[model samples]
Target: MEQISTDVAIIGAGPAGMFAVFECGMLKMSCVLIDALDELGGQCVALYPEKPIYDIPAHPAIEGAALIAQLEQQIAPFGCVKLLGRQVTGLAGEAGNFTLTTSMGDKISAKAVVLAAGAGAFGPNRPPLDGLSAYEASGAVRYYVKRREDLRGKRVVIAGGGDSAVDWALALQGVAAHIAVVHRRPKFRAAPESTAQLDALAAEGKVEMVIPYQLHALHGQDGVLQAVEVVDLDGAPRKLETDVLLPFFGLATELGPIAEWGLDLAQHHVTVTPATMETSISGIFAVGDIASYPGKLKLILQGFAEAAMAAHAIYGLVNPGMALHFEHSTTKGVPG
Candidate 1:
């Protein structure tokens, strides 16, 4: 097995994990980032890379792929080590000295560990319907719309009441020839503004609102979708003719091996101290969506703040006798 050593071992190369590298580098600490995915960005790059994100602080709106591109540029100067396409299957040892074993039969030794794994090991929640796999294989049913251009001039049926459903409905309005939104209830679980926009589009005859209905069956042959069958409270069937069906039912996520690390767990997340972002086990910290605390917000911005806190706390463990004189970014410029 190949052996590696670092000051901090960051498990997950998402936005938070990438930023953790910068934060640790600024404090003169070397880091090694490990992730199951082959690429840098976690969900952003894998799922919905073209989707627009409106709440990223400075930029009014940015796509998932673009946000990751900017993050890659921001952390380029640090030149941190990356162990992609590998999953950390085992963790052992104590604070200031820990070893992590990966799926690729590699061992990594680090002084501290940071868990920035956003909803570790996630996949879409597909609806339970017969012949679904055929459609999925034929590109008729998809959980994510990687590109809108693929749906151009095609009839699309979007099912769900969440943000993803509403957002995609609005995004593909002009692109798709016909758009129908199917939901079990009239009320949407998405943002009020977005729901209102969807309502406006419905009123304008640009969208069809199939409310109080749930997907019941799929009508197709040989992996080609002919129409979607839905039902209401009374079991009355309604068929929606469409070329494609997008079910934005959200993702099914698991903590995976991180759950067995002996850290305190709440639900599926690691319980951590908000002050330092450290887990119940010393020297092993948790951040991003995997860390749980009082009033925790699952936002990328919040994850960035938590990464900074974890790095500051790890500094103490890496340099036991030394003090971290806090200096603003303006005071100390980044490495060239």
Candidate 2:
């Protein structure tokens, strides 16, 4: 096993983790960024590369892939070591001196650790349908729409009653030939404004709302989707012919090896100090969606703030007695 050392070991290459590199770099700290995915940007690049995000500060609107590209560029000057396509399976030692073991048989030693894992090791909650894997392999069934253009002119059957389901329905309005939303309840869990927009589209005959229904079975042969079978609460079955099935039942997230690292956890999220974003264990911090505290908002922008706090707090641990005279970005420009 190869051994590496750094001032801070950052897990997860998502938006928060990527930003943490810049924050730490600005403080003259070195970082080693690690993630399970082969690529950076986490779900932004992997799931909805084409999806437009509106809440990010500065830019009024930016697509997922574009946002990640900008973050990558922002952190490029940091020269942080990136360990992709591997997971950190073991964490040992204490504050100021920690050791980590990855699944690829590599060991990392760091003075501090930051966990920016957004919904650590996340995957879609696939419906329990027969031959689901076959259709998934052939792109007949998909959990995430990586690119909207892939579904152009195709009939789509969307399942679930969350923001993802409603948002995607609205996003694919002009792109898809036809769209039918399947939900187990009439009331959606999405934002009120988005739900209202979907209702307006449905009333205008641009979308179909199949409420109080759940996915029953998939009708297809050789991984080619032909129709989707849905049933109501009373067991009434209905078949909707479609070329694709997009199930947005949310993600099945697991902390995996992170759970055994002796950190305080609440509802599968790492409980952290609100001010410093530090976990129960010293030298280890948790931020982003995988972090939880009182009145914590699961927003990317909020995670960015947390990453800054964690980096600032970690400066003391990494530098011992040295004081971190904080300077505004205007005064302390990024490394050239």
Candidate 3:
């Protein structure tokens, strides 16, 4: 029942949204940032934080979590209100005066809005596990790992082959008593270094790996997960015991309610007028993992570029009398 307003509203506090906040702060603009996760850094926080980020310029390699920490710390210098562990259930109104409702039942309005909720909403494919919903609570199982401390001394069994799986395998190294990574295929889809590190760890007997298999049954006792049964390659059956199970099969979806906003998605980038991250809705823009221009390169660096450009456009809409931050032709984000 509470209502608030600000100069700008950001739906996500991830990398793209974080960058947008940094710029908005520099511009002395009042803004509110909201995210489904409990903190800043979307993928970095929700999926895998300890994973190294190689594409960021000037920093050859950075852990996703560390990078997010740096971002959070840097943004702290600015006075911005952060709404974590909340989802924006609905958005309505014109460009300058928009209203937002959260799943937590709080409502707010803003002059302009930015949608930078990278691939988090539509989450990991929860392929029918039968009792999945029943066992999901009690922290015995989860789709993502937020804090490393939560994993200390606990045995974990992960299912997937993407970056999240590999990143977590490496992140939970010393903390987890034991880790078993399961994938439906023999080959992994993570970056070379990440996969290489996991491979080395497995070879050194640091972790257990299962290939060409997936979860068939999730067993629990006393209202807590006890173990899991998996079918391996060649239709072999196997069972693994652990305190936790993480299924990170990569972003198992498209846009959430944003798809209802109606934007043309072609090759990851929104079909938009070049240089403008604008979507079908005027004054509304889509950037980062959710958007790409006709030929713009899709990279973390590119997402920042899109976000920066989108900010400028929003600035123009909010205050045409003021100067825009950066030029459209120029790319200026964390140049990777």
Candidate 4:
């Protein structure tokens, strides 16, 4: 088994978790960022990279993927160690000293832990259809679209009524040769403007809206899709000949082993001390959406502030009896 050690172990690689690396670096602490997902950015990259977010202070609008890219660039100078595509299954030790074991059998030792797992380990809610996994393996079906060019000139069927399904249909307006959106209801959960745009595309004959339908079966071989079978409310089945299928039902989150780590959880979120962002455990801190407190607003900016506070508290815990004179980033440049 591979073994690694660092001053702090950050348990999530989302925006807040990545920001925690910058905060810890400012305190002259090295961090090892670990996440269950194969890539960083947590919910943003894994769920909806193209979705626009308007509430991230200072920026008028930004996509989920763009925000993650900027955060990754911001922490580049710090050289934060990353351990991705693995789930942390075991946590041992205490304040100023702890060890973590992942599902891949790697062990990490650290002086402190920052649990920035936003909504815990998240995964797309797969549609219930026989042979769905086979199609996913063959690249005929996808839950998340990493690149728009991949779907260019293809017949695509999107399933869902939410932002992902609606926004993607609009995004692929000119990219895909033919795009059809299948939803169980005519109403959508996406923003008004996005829905309006999708409707405009449908009116223009560039997109097809298959309302009140659910996926019945998949026809394909070796994960390659030949067509998709969908059924309407009256059990009327229709087969859509398409090259690709995208099912964006939503995401399902689970705390997994983090729940068994002895931390107090309320509504699947870790309870933390407001002043320090420390969990029930002394050196284990929780921030971002995974951390809960009285009147806590689940915002990116709020988590950023909590990360800074947790980093300061962790610095003291990692280095006992050492006086810390905090200074602004402008005062002290990035450490080499």
Candidate 5:
């Protein structure tokens, strides 16, 4: 078993977790970050790299990938140990001394732990259809868009009514030879601006809106999609011929082994003290969407604030009885 030690161990590489690294580093604390994804940015990169985000403090608008890149740059000075593509299998010990085991048979010993995993481990909610696995193996169906070029010049059918579905429908307009959007309702769950763009594209006859219908079946040869069978509210079937199908039914979240860590859980989220972002177990903190408290806003900015609190609190555990001389980044500058 591989063993490592740090002042703090953060269990996510999302915006909040990355910011935690910066915060801890600012206080002269060393940290190690672990994430299940091969890369950082968590859901931002995995779910919607091209998705635009507003309401971030400084920037009025920023794409998901851009925001992640910026966060990565912000934390680069910290030089925290990054253990990517690993899941925490077991957590042992207590405050001031914790042992975390990963699926890769690696062990991390840290003075404090921070749970910044956003929505925990998430996977796309696969649409229910017979032979769906077979079609998926053939590459005709996908849960998310990894490459825009793959959809270029292809007949694509986007399924679902959420932001991801409509956003991709608008994004793929010029790239796809023909596009169709299938949803159970005409109403979209996407942002108004994105929905408007999709609406405009449909009005321009660039894309087809197959509304009030649910995916009934998929017909294809060896994973090459020929047509998609959908059922309308009236139970009438319609066949849409397409080469590819993109389903954006959202994600199914699971905390997995973390749920068994004996922390106070509210639904799928771990409950933390709003004052210090600490969990029931001392030295173990929770932040981001996976962390919850009264009046907790599930925003990136909120998580950022929580990370700061968790980092400061963790500083105490890492260096017992040591008074922290707080200094602004402008005054001290980021330590090299």
Candidate 6:
């Protein structure tokens, strides 16, 4: 419906996107950051925000939401040129003039494009219990629990055995009325510490651990989830009363359009130069979870480093013959 133009087009608004935005502004390049969330913060908001992240450079440990909020504040002075709550369905052209099409029927042009889409958009693979769809569409069923304070006194049934399930269980321990985790298998993919804690919860009877089972269906009355059908280990069915059915079956995020762009991906992530964070495509670069380089580390701190290099490289492309001085002297990426 409308056309916008800028120096760089950022498709996702996560950690790397935040870093890249500031970097672009420092280089005097205008940017248009498009994402599905109205407020910034990407996966931090999409996933668990209260979870402490230790690997991010200086501070040692900060909650995911806190980090995102801080990043938003840091980029506030830049004044985002354009932030649209829409998906970039398509991309055409290359450096110095890449085009992005939105789901809302809008077109934006940019000098270069950055694919900082981390893990992409993800949700649960299966609904928590049977018939929970009633509350799902009406603003009930959620995959990732971002707001810890909201779950106070609420009964939540989480499904899955991954880090997400384990993390949320711990995060919501005191906040929720009753917490239950049901996975298809007893073995979990979460860290040993997390699993051990869950085991403790199970022993304490604070958490109901349902192993080798799944939520069969949800039963609701008057447009609210009332009961859930759970199949137990011995192929038996049981019903539990639930106000909310939360399926924490990890994120099923798909790279989709980005993958179709053919930017070269190894293990479902964009491949880039470790030092430069530049991808196979000249003007298109990647800097976060969605990107990987020779010795690329997927941590947020590492993403920050990659973002810096990508910014410098982008500046070099925009302004030719400009003496680019890299701040970080140690450079050891897949060289050009």
TM-score of model 3 relative to the true fold?
0.78
**TM-score per candidate, chains pooled:** 0.98, 0.98, 0.78, 0.87, 0.94, 0.86
Residue-level lDDT for 326 in candidate 5: 87
Error of 2 at 156 (Å): 0.3
Clashes of 4: 0
Candidate 3 per-residue C-alpha lDDT over 1-336 given as tens digits, one digit per residue, 9 for 90 to 100: 456778788878888888888766655666788888886888776666756778998889997888888878877866778888888888788877788898888788887887887753757677578678766777777887768899899989998888778888998999999999988887898889878999999999999988878888888875488888899666778889988888886566555666655557665445555577777767677777766555666577877777667777778766767876553324543222
TM-score of 2: 0.98
**Against the correct fold, how does model 4 do in TM-score?**
0.87
For model 6, the superposed segments whose C-alpha errors exceed 4 Å read 1-4, 104-107, 128-130, 138-140, 327-336
Q: Among all windows of ten consecutive residues in candidate 3, which has the lowest summed lDDT? A: 327-336
Candidate 4 stretches greater than 4 Å from native: 1-5, 47-66, 220-222, 294-299, 322-324
Native-to-model Cα distance after best TM-score fit, residue 140 in candidate 3, in Å? 3.5
Over the stretch 198-281, how does candidate 5's per-residue lDDT look in tens digits?
888889999899988999999987777899999999999999999988999999999989999999999989999898999998
lDDT, candidates in the order shown: 0.94, 0.94, 0.77, 0.91, 0.90, 0.79
Candidate 3 colliding pairs: 49-65, 96-111, 269-292, 270-292
Clashes of each: 0, 0, 4, 0, 0, 4
Q: Candidate 4 or 5, higher lDDT? A: 4
Off by over 4 Å in 2: none
**Least lDDT summed over 10 consecutive residues: which range in candidate 1?**
327-336
**Which tens-of-lDDT digit does each residue in 142-202 have in candidate 1?**
9988899999999999999999999999999789999999999999999999999999999
